[model samples]
Every structure is written in C-alpha cells, then in structure tokens.
Target: MKVRDKVIVVTGAGGGIGRELVFNLLYKGAKVAAIDINSDALEETLKQAGGDGDKVSTHIVNLTDREAVEKLPEQVISCHGTVDGIVNNAGIIHSFVNINDLDYDKIKLVMDINFYGTLYMVKSFIPYLLDRPVGHVTNVSSMGGFLPVPGQSIYGASKAAVKLMTEGLYAELKDTSVNVTVVFPGGVRTDIMKNSKVEGVPSTNDTDKAHDHLLTPKEAAEIIINGMEKDQYRVLAGKDAKMMDKLYRLSPQRAVSIITKQMKKIINK
Candidate 1:
C-alpha cells in the first residue's frame, strides 16, 4: 500500500491535484504513469516533475472510453513492469445551473466524464489489481458528492455515484490486498472551473469568497497520498469537507439549508 518504490498509475495528471499527486508520488519514490487527456498538459507536468524521468511516464487517453481504459493496465505494465495502485483523479464539473434549467446533454456529459469514466478505469484495472499481491485504488469525489450543492446538482449526482461505487468496491475487496479509498475534497485552489469550461458564472462558489480557506493542490495531494499509504477507506481533504461531513451526519436538513442558502444568494445576485 505504501507508494514508495511501487508502480502507481494516476489519471488526470495534467494539472491541479492530479499533477501534484504525480510530483508527490515521484518524490515518495513511486514509479508513476501519469495519464491525462491533454498530452501538452501531461508534458508540462512531466517537465515540472524535474529529475527522476526514469521513474515517470506519461499517457494520453480519454477515460470515458472503455476500450481506452482497458489498454491502460497493459500500457503501464509495459512501461513500469508491474502495477501496485491507481489514483482516479480525473473529473469534470457541470455547468452551474438549477435542476429545472439544466440541459440533459450537460448532465450526460458530466456523468460520462466524472462518474462512468472512473468506473471504466476501476473495471479495467480490477483484474490486474487482484492479481497483484497488494494494490490500492483511490477515487476522488467532491464534497458536493455528499452535501447537495444547489447549482451543481448534476455534478453532485455524478460524484455521489462515485462515492457509493467506491464504498461498494471497498466492501467487495475487503478480503483482498486491494484497498479502496474515496476522497472528499472541499474547495481547493485549482482551475477546475476553467478546466470544466464553466460559462456565465463566477468560477468560485459564493462560500469561497466568504472564506478563503481553500487547500493548495500540493497539500491536498499530500493528504491523499498519505491516506493511500495507510490504505484508508475515506480521505477528506480540506477542513471544510471534514466539517461538512460531521454537520451533514448530524443534521441533513440543517446542512442542506446552510449550503443551499449560500448558493441561492449567488443565484439571486
């Protein structure tokens, strides 16, 4: 489970937390296959990885494609000789829109990229992971996955699906050496809105402006990798997520009211 000297494949390795994961994993002495849809971005990440080029490799693939995902385990094996774990960090946000104003196409798009894409990678890599004496899987689900966000309903739905799917995987793989972890990341300092290509809205959420407590990508990555090293079933990055988890558990209606009020203020503004 420790990434040190282990071969780990990471998706969405172009920027944000994914890129940070690559840098951190390599620093921890893991043989890394950095994957992303943007070959140029991957190149950028590779360049930023500094030395240890021998321990790092890059791959370009769209995770939504099952056939493309199916080839990943083999490609990583060819590059690194063996696989030890995977971090499914690739995801996209939905256009900020209310449920009634939402476009079905947009919902489908987010679902394909954020939820099904993660599932494709898990499905493709499970056999190989099972074959290994020990392996790990980490899925990045947003805090919105559990706490319903007003404008990002579809995005929340997608991530919520990932949360449940990952939890189910952990139960199924309980006896196996493969550990499953689902990460709940609150607001982190990243260009996720730009990456998701949001239009006609401020990139940051209303609450983000009120509280500048976003975690840095590197910090988030460190927390995530630490959880992976320990084979944790759940990893909450950022204080907001940790706090929200407790609040939601304590009072679902009150939690929804608090978040919905913040988002509604932005919508009405």
Candidate 2:
C-alpha cells in the first residue's frame, strides 16, 4: 500500500486534500493519475507540484457519470501504464437546511456525488487494482456521515452509505492484495462548501469559534496517505473526528444532542 512507485488514481484531485494528495504522492515517487471535474483546477494542482508534475497524469471527468467513471482505469493505464490504488476523496454537502425544508433534488445531488460517485470509482477501478500485486482504496466519509448534523441529515445519510459500503468492500476483499481503508475526517479546511455551491459561512466549531476546527488539507492528506501505506483499516483525521467517534459509540443520543446545539447556530444564522 505504500504509494512509492505505485500508479494511484485520485478523484477530486483538483483542489483541497485531493490536490495535496497529488503533491504528496509525487513526493513519494508515485505515478499519480489525478482525476477531477475541473480541468483548470487540475492544471493548477500540477503547477503547484512544480517539477514533480512529470510523474502525474490529469483527467477531467465527472464522477457522477458512470460511463466516465468506468473509462478512467483504461485511460489511466494508457497514461501511467498500470493501476495500483485509488483514493475516493470527492464528496459534497447540501446547503445547510433541514431535510423537511430542503428539496429532494438537493438530497439526491448529495447522494449521487458523495455516495454513488465513490461507488463508481471503486467499481470501475477495482478490477484493475485486483490485477496488481497490491492495491489500496481509501474512501473518505465525513464525521457528519456518522453523527447527526441538524441541517445536514441528507448529507450525513449519503456519507453513512459510503461508510458502510467501504466496510463491506473491506470484508469482501480481505483475502485479496487490495486493501480497503475508510477515513472519517472531522472538520477540514477546504473549499468544499464553495465547490458544492453552498453559499454562506457554516456554523464552525473552530478554536476561534468562527471557523470549523479545521485541519489543513496537507495535514489531512498526509494522515490519509500514511494510513494507506500502513494498511490501516480505519483512519480518523482531526481531534474532533476522534472525539466524536468515541462519544457517539458510547452514547448516540448524547452525541446527537451535542451536535444539534452546535448546528442550530449555523442553521439559524
């Protein structure tokens, strides 16, 4: 699972942690196939990599399109020669609104992008990955995916699906060279809200109380890639995600109550 010399395919590689992963993977001497919906952003990621960009391949495609997702492995192999791993890091959140007040289309959008998009990448890439001597798949689910956030119930449900799906994949692929890692990140400092087209500031629990206690994209990517190399079954990024995982495991009702109090401020604002 070490990324060194591995041909790894990364979705959402245009920005945020995905962009950071491209950089770190290059630093590790991995042949990276960077996939994103935005061509310009993907170029920017390559630009940031400086000379290391030579080791990377950039693909602009929408994960929501099954055909596009399915074709990625072949395109990557054609460009990078082989596939060894994949990072399902693309995801989005619905606008901060209660389920009752939100449109069902918004819910579907979240589900399609966050849950099914990850699924498409996994299904399309797994056959190729299985052909390798060893491969790893890292699926990013949110803390919201597990714990209840008042205005983000639908978003939570979608990520919850990803959480369960990835675990199921782990069980099925346990005997294979392919490894599965499910990541739960707390609050990451990224442009995901803006990328998701969600306007306005979120109710943040940052130390400053103005931003989410956000882990930088590079920090989060390092933890994730390191976890993949170590073949960890689960990786929790950020202190908040670790704390919430423990709290929710011990008392789901209490956890939900705590989240509601914090989220109410954001939703009402």
Candidate 3:
C-alpha cells in the first residue's frame, strides 16, 4: 500500500534504519508515530525532521514491555486519528558468545526483545490493521535468521523465530487487506552493540575489516520501505542478505561454514 497520507508506526525510530525509515516515510507524505525506549533519541529524530516535524509524533516505548505495547495502538490512534502500518524494527543482540557460555538471562533478553517484541507489536496492532482499507505489517528479521553465525546462536534463533512467525502471518492474512512482509538484513552500520549494552566487543582491525561492506542505514531503510510499498512476501535488505539467502537455500551446511569463518573475526572467543 502507498504510504502517502497514511499513519505509519515505526519501532526503533530513534536511530539507524528505523530513523531513516521515518525520514523516508515522511518524504513520501506519510504521518509517522516514532516509538523508541530513548526519549532523547526520539527527540533527536523529531528535531532532525525539521519542517516535517509537524508530521511526526514521538513515543517513548520499550517494545519488550507488553503492557506498554498493548496500549500503543490506542495512543497512536489518539494522536494520528488512525494507524495504517507498523514496522517492527526494534531489536538487539547479545554479547558474542556460544550458547554454552551464554547465561539464561542473556538468552531470555535476546528472545524477549527480538522475537517476542515483534510478536507483541503484531498482536497489538493487527486488529487495527485488519480494519483499515489498506494496512501493512513489516517485520525485520536478519541474515542470521536463515544462516548460522557462530557465537550468535541465540540471536540467530530469535531472528529465525521472527522469520517463521512473519511468514505465517503472511499466509494467514493473504485474503485480507493487511499485507505482511518479512525482512532479512545483513550487516548494517549502526550502534547495535552499544545500544544492546554488549560487553567485550572487539574493535580490532580484522573486525572492522569484516564489516567494511556493511550497508548504510539509509540504504537498508529504502529497500525495506520499497518492499512494504510493493507488499512483498520477503525482502533481503542488503546484497549480503540476498546472496546469503540464496546460498542457504542451495546448501545450508556450506552457507553456515562460510558465515562461521567470516564471523570468527568478531565473535568473542
């Protein structure tokens, strides 16, 4: 569905692709409700909106808080009159470590924010989306969701859950006005490690080299919004994501091995 004049809610709108999405949607003439846990960051996004700031509203929301999320739809409606689309973009990764070394708390935190967070947004807003003439649900998964990345097993698992759940939602809503899209993004330049409060992250030259080809947030957001506009079933946000998706489909084991080698540079031993 076209976003022009529509009220679109974007989670994680404080920074990275989510912030770029807010800019792009406003450029397309859409009103946006930006949600993020950081009030200051949300304010920054609004401040950057400049003349378009009037078309946006910022909401401080921790996506992991289900009660807060459940109240989001009504709050958005109250501000924007009605909501037509939701981009489930808020998520985080755990400290780079094997599942064996990862504690339960870290695992749960990853699952809660990455998988369950998206689930809550979907559940809370789907009913409202279903009622709209042209509604959309876009969930951002990851390349790790489809390919195994050593030391990020739990992070991959959470994203894999998002992948499957979004696909299922697509099938269920096929006959309805609500369009569902699942997105897989490869390396994107962002402050995810800092935002996730991940410890012991390597800043070695090798690690930087490994991520030198990462997509910019604006590029990733453009691909995602284009997919949403076309009502695509799946969107691969980077060239790496697109290539890896094909490789994983052809030979999962080989794909896993390839990524394992590349990730070794950054994964904490």
Candidate 4:
C-alpha cells in the first residue's frame, strides 16, 4: 500500500513501536488516528509527531473493551473521512510464571488485550475496509509467537493466536481488496517491559545483550511498510526474527529447545 495520503489508524500509539510507527507514517504523509489508553503518553506521541493537529488525532481507548473498540471505526472515520489501513499494535504481556502458578486474572488480562483487542479492531474495521477498493491490516505479533518462551507463556500464546488469526484473515481475504500482514519483531529498545504485566519483572532493565541484535522501531516500521506495500503475508523485523522463523520452519522441536535455553537465563535471573 502506498502510505502517502493513506488514512491510517494505529492502536497503542503511545508506546514503543506504535509511537514510532505513528511518527514514521506521518512523515510518509499518512493521516493517522493514534489510539492508546494512556492520555499522557498519547500526548507525548503527538508532541513528537510534530504534525498539524488535523493530520494526526489521538484517542484514549481501552482496546480490551469491545464497546470502545466497536466505536473506533466511526471515530476514526469522523476524523479522517475514510480508513485505508489499521495497525493492530496494541498489546500487553503477563509476568513470567509457570502455567500452574500463573495468575488466572492476569492471564485473562493479557489475552483480552493482546488477542481480543486485535480481533475487535479487525471486526470493527472490516466493513469500512470492504467499502474501499483496497485496505491493509498490519498486526504486530512477536518472535515469541513462533517459539515458546517458558516464563512468558501467556504472552507467547496471545501472539501465537494473533499469528494464526492474521494468517486466517489473509487466506480468507486473498482475492479481496483488504490485505493482511503479520509482523514478528525480535528485541528492540522500548518501554514494553515497563508497561508489561510480568510479575517480579523489573520495570526497567538493560537489554544490551538483546539490543546488540535488536532492530530499531524505525527499521521495523520500514520493513512493515514495505511488506504491506508488497502484500507480504509475513514480515520479519530483524536478523533474529528471520533466523528464528527459519529455525522454526526447519525444526520446530530444536527451535523450541534453543529458545527455552535462551529464555531460561533471562527468566531465572
């Protein structure tokens, strides 16, 4: 999809990759509707975007709430006149814990925000997209979506659900004007940890080891934009993401073992 002049709506626009995506899309001449639960962070994103208020609009919405998500299309349409694309970038991660010991409430929270949130957005926007000749939906899954991470099982499951759901949407919409793209992003410098629900997990920690192999949000956004333009079904955001996808494809068991070993060190710390 040519991002120039496209009317785009990005959820979780207050944080990390979402914030970067909004800025990048704005620079590419897309009118953006930025949505996040955090008003302050949304304001910060707007300030950083440096676009005319008319070019960028912000909405404080709790994505997990189906009612709120249901209203998003109308709200976005009111602001942009039409919706050409949507980035389901809003997500939440639960704390690292064995399934047996995991807090059910927290797990529900994660699933609601990460899984149902994506579904709600897609459900609400598909009608509008169908009206147009072409539309795009870019969902941000994670490297964990392909490989199991012991402590972050809930997060992994949520993203895995997203992966499959997105693929299903792609297969079903292949002949249509709407396109679906799923992204698997490896480590990146972001505030996700601070906002995540990982119990006993530090709000802030050095990700230097991961950063060495991390793709900046700008890089990831570029890859995603290109993938959407080319109508790619999957977009791997970094070397690590691509390698992991390859490994999982060649040997699922071995890939899981390797991811388990690497994640053990982080979770056990």
Tens-digit per-residue lDDT, 160-257, candidate 3: 99999999999999999999999999989887878888878753223566667889888999999999999999999888998999999999899988
lDDT of 1: 0.90
Q: In candidate 1, what are the lDDT values of residues 55-99, reduced to their tens digit?
A: 999989998888998999999999889998999999988777888
lDDT of candidate 3? 0.91
Expressed as tens digits, the lDDT of each residue in 1-269 for candidate 4 is 88889999999999788998898888788999999999999999999988578999999999889999999999998988999999998887776778888888988999999999999999999989989888999998999998888888889999999999999999998899999999988876666877874456543346555446667777777787788778788998888888988999999999889988977766666
Which residue pairs collide, candidate 3?
none
- Counting clashing residue pairs in each candidate, in order, gives 0, 1, 0, 3
Q: Model 2, 269: alpha-carbon shift in Å?
A: 5.2
TM-score of each: 0.95, 0.95, 0.95, 0.95
The TM-score obtained by model 1 is 0.95
Question: Scored by CA lDDT, what does every candidate get?
Answer: 0.90, 0.89, 0.91, 0.87
Model 2 CA deviation exceeding 4 Å by range: 51-53, 202-209
Deviation (Å) of 194 in candidate 3:
0.9
Count steric clashes of candidate 4.
3
Instruction: Indicate the worst ten consecutive residues by lDDT in candidate 4.
Output: 202-211
